[model samples]
Target: MLIVGLTGNIGSGKSSVARLLKEMGARVIDTDQVAREVVAPGTPGLQQIIDHFGTGVLNADGALDRPKMAQIVFNDTNALKRLNSIVHPAIRAQLLKAIADYRDNPDAPLMVIEAPLLIETQLFKLVDQVWMVTVDAKTQIQRVIKRDAVTAEQVSSRLAAQMPQEDKLPYAQRVIDNSGTPEATLQQVRQIWSDAIDRSQAQAE
Candidate 1:
């Protein structure tokens, strides 16, 4: 199976694109979703997180308090890295298992791994190709502000903490401009899905 990295700056509709890929019959392993699943209240991953950040990041049900934890990392770089350190390895291991299972089953020719921090975590190196979904800074900040219901400065600060889309573009095998309508974005994804199937078949031969 051919593995591709799908990433984008925050608020770039990267999840939407991933869903489109799923609709195209590509097995997409969303690392963010896996991160949450691996750390459910009683899991070893969740226990490690509580040991690191304390009980403050938990809800009444002992589940993760996303906003509280997000606030902690959004402002502190080292804290963010530490959190990723704890979470990312587990996510990568889980994804590798998923990939192995997919290949063993031979269900599809291609698979996508969706990670918001693909570039930041250096996980891009694991993929056969990278596809970056990007938009200009002005659009990025505005979209994030509107979507997250935060101030421009807050959005800017969060965006600043991540590796910029500009820096990631050169690393991408293809770029998907996400500053358009949902229909338009899906159109691009559909084309890529068909193309990837062909590429995967060639690689298998």
Candidate 2:
């Protein structure tokens, strides 16, 4: 299977692109979802997190208080780094397992690993190609503010934590500009899907 590493900074419309890929029959392994799984209520990952950050990070139901934790890490670079240290390894292991499973499945047309930190974590090395979704800074800021319901400052801090779009662009084998309308974005996705199919067939021949 062709493995496509999908990445972009905060508010870059990566999830939307991933959805389009799913609609086009790609098996997507979302690392952000995997990150949540590693820290579920009964897991050791949760215990370790509680040990480091205290019970304050958990909700009354014993679930991770994601918004509170985001507030904590968004302001503190050290706290964010520490959190990544705890969560990244577990996420990487699970992501690799997922990729392996998809690789073994003959019916999986393509495998797309959706990771926000793909460039920073060097996870792009695992894929056959990298597809980066990008948007203008103004659009990114607006989208983040609307989606996260956070202050512009908070969104800026979060975006600062990731690789800049300009830097990430050079690393991509394909770039999908999603700063326009949804229909336009979907049209780009369709073109990429067609190209991927052509490449797969050529390789088989």
Best by TM-score: 2
lDDT of 1 by residue, 94-185 (tens): 88788778768867666889989888888887788999898777887888888889999888777877887888888899788889887888
lDDT of 1 at 104: 85
| Poorest lDDT segment (10 consecutive residues) of candidate 1 | 102-111
Model 1 RMSD in angstroms: 1.9
Evaluate all candidate structures by whole-model CA lDDT and list the values in order: 0.85, 0.90
Winner by lDDT: 2
TM-score of each: 0.90, 0.90
Instruction: Identify the runs in model 2 with alpha carbons over 4 angstroms from their true place.
Output: 150-154
lDDT of 2 at 18: 99
lDDT of 2 by residue, 125-167 (tens): 8889999999999999999999989999989887766778999
